[model samples]
Target: MLSESSRPIIESTLQTIAERINDITVIFYRKMFEYHPELMDGMFSRADQAEGIQPRALAGSVPVFASYILANPDSYPDEMLARIAHKHASLGVTADQYEIVYKYLFAAIAENLGDACTPEIAEAWTEVYWLMADVLVKIEKGLYDGQKNDVIHSNFKLVSRKEAGTSVLDMIFEPADSTVMSDAVAGQYVTVIVKTEDGLRQPRQYTLLPSAQNQRRIAVKQNEDGEVSPMLHKLEVGDIIEISNPYGDVVLGGYSDQDSQPLYLFSAGIGIVPMVAFLAELKKNHSKRSVVAVHADSSSEAWPLREEYLKLVAELDDAKAISFLKDGEGDFQGEVRVESLDMPRLASVYMCGPLSYMQSVRSALVQQGIPGRNIQYEIFGPDQWILRATRRSMRGNRV
Candidate 1:
């Protein structure tokens, strides 16, 4: 909750701060990285920093959070906070790091705002920052406590590697030590940490695919321009790597309580990773719910886990699968035509793909009278969904 004394101050200056938030964040990252260059080695992504995506995400989130708290002072944004906390837990973020971030973030704000940032304004913003930071710290602590082991990363030896689809490698790994492995739920992800040739450690998160209890499986799409995926693709069968415990809020069976509701799973290209896991879990449980699996790709040959995806759906009595291929044989051609599908408006939808693809599909669903709350999405990298949604809402209000 925001302090009563600071609420009016924040309300008065929020527009001014919001206008310069992007500039403030850019300065903040520059000053922080200049002072502590080691953060780039493992914790933060240099590519995202260079592209300015990280700063934009931070800039968008602070004002959104402030607005939310102002409107509803008794509660925080649980979904947004959980998503952030899960990602932080996967990367082993510590409470002390929040202090380091505060030092540079406020310094940037002071530097940018100049004479307009009075002592009272700075104090109010400080309270807001700490309030948000404290909530994240608490949530991350709970996630860490729920893990099977106290360590952030554990050694895993590669057991097998096979090509699942075009440019996608299916790798299986087993614990190299006696570290207890947590039971991973479907749709969760694990962070893989590897050392580059330059002796710098880089961490990347990959969704955990279905496998045996003692084995961990992940399908990695080799990104030619990525810092980590290329190295992951070159690993031999007997190689060792570090992996974090599985952590994600999106799961196969826990999103809603309506067990008999129609379930729709949508994916595109390498986004089929989590959809496959969800199908495998449902097959294992013999779920009788009405299930529709939809996928889109450039070609049927380019779809990762195509056969396995269809096979699982085939085994289920009340399930069916469809594909939309741009240049090859499928049930439909071109991009996903969500309007043409015969799905119930009340069905639960889980979508994973590129952000633009998901946004288009979501718009189609909304036009068909489907409730926005019924749809859930997972982003593979830094999430800008909330920021984008906030912009959309602001635009709608103006109209």
Candidate 2:
């Protein structure tokens, strides 16, 4: 909890801080990268940086955390903090790195705040920063300890590579060393680090599909101008790359794999990754739970792991798969109309995909008498949609 002295100051200046947080974040990144060129090499995504996704996420998260801590005198944002920690752990973020971040971040705050800033305000914000950082450090450490091996960078040899769909490569990998693979739960992801042709190692997180303990499968969507995925596509069966331990907490069936309630898995574009992962887990257990797998893509051919998902969904005892495509062939034509689904009562909904798509689906679900708390969403990148949805709901405003 923030000190009593800091509360009024934060409340008084929160609007200004929120208004200028973006500038602070952007400047923080630019200056941080300017000073620490090494972070740009592999630890950070140059693409995300250039696109300003990272900055916006940082900007959004800071004020959100502050507001939450300020409003709730005792509680912390566990889900948000866990997601952030998992993402950092995927990138091999260390506790010491927080020092580097704090230094540049404080400078950015001070520079942006200017005349409004005072030592007391700075000290209070600094306390908030460290509080968040300290918690993340502990969470990340726990995650690292739970893994089979503590190796942040381990070699995974490509066992096979095949086309899953248009512009998608289904790459299978096995341990290139003696390290044993830990059985990662469904909906978990691993960070694949590829050494680009430019001699920079870049890491990108991909969700795991159900596979043997000794093997891992990840479908990579080719980016025409991607720094890493394109290079990864060129590698053959015998080639090797670095992969992190499977880590992500968006799990299904951890406690009640046998639950008979309806489990709605929704996806858009590559958001199908986690859906497939969950489906694989359910299938492996021969789950009798009712499943509705909904997906949307540009076309049938453009859908990654379409055949695999179709087969798996069919294999389930009580599961129906639906697809909507703008230019689809055979079945699954036109855009998705969420209101049209035969709504299930007391359903456990999980969603991933484009922010707009999830937001629309979630809104539709909530209107159809589905509890807002029942809907769970996972973002492929920094989480923006959830916060927006949550805030809108909390304020009792129409979206």
TM values, all candidates: 0.95, 0.94
Positional deviation of residue 177's Cα in model 1 after best superposition, in angstroms: 1.8
The residue pairs in collision within model 2 are none
As a TM-score, model 2 comes out at 0.94
- Candidate 2 lDDT over residue span 209-288, tens digit each: 87776998998888898778898899999999999888887888434655656899989888898999998888888888
User: After superposition, which runs of candidate 1 have C-alpha atoms over 4 Å from their true positions?
Assistant: 255-258, 390-399
Cα error of candidate 2 at position 169, Å: 0.6
Each candidate's clash count: 0, 0
- lDDT agreement with native, every candidate: 0.87, 0.82
Candidate of highest lDDT: 1
Runs in model 2 deviating more than 4 A are: 254-260, 328-332, 389-399
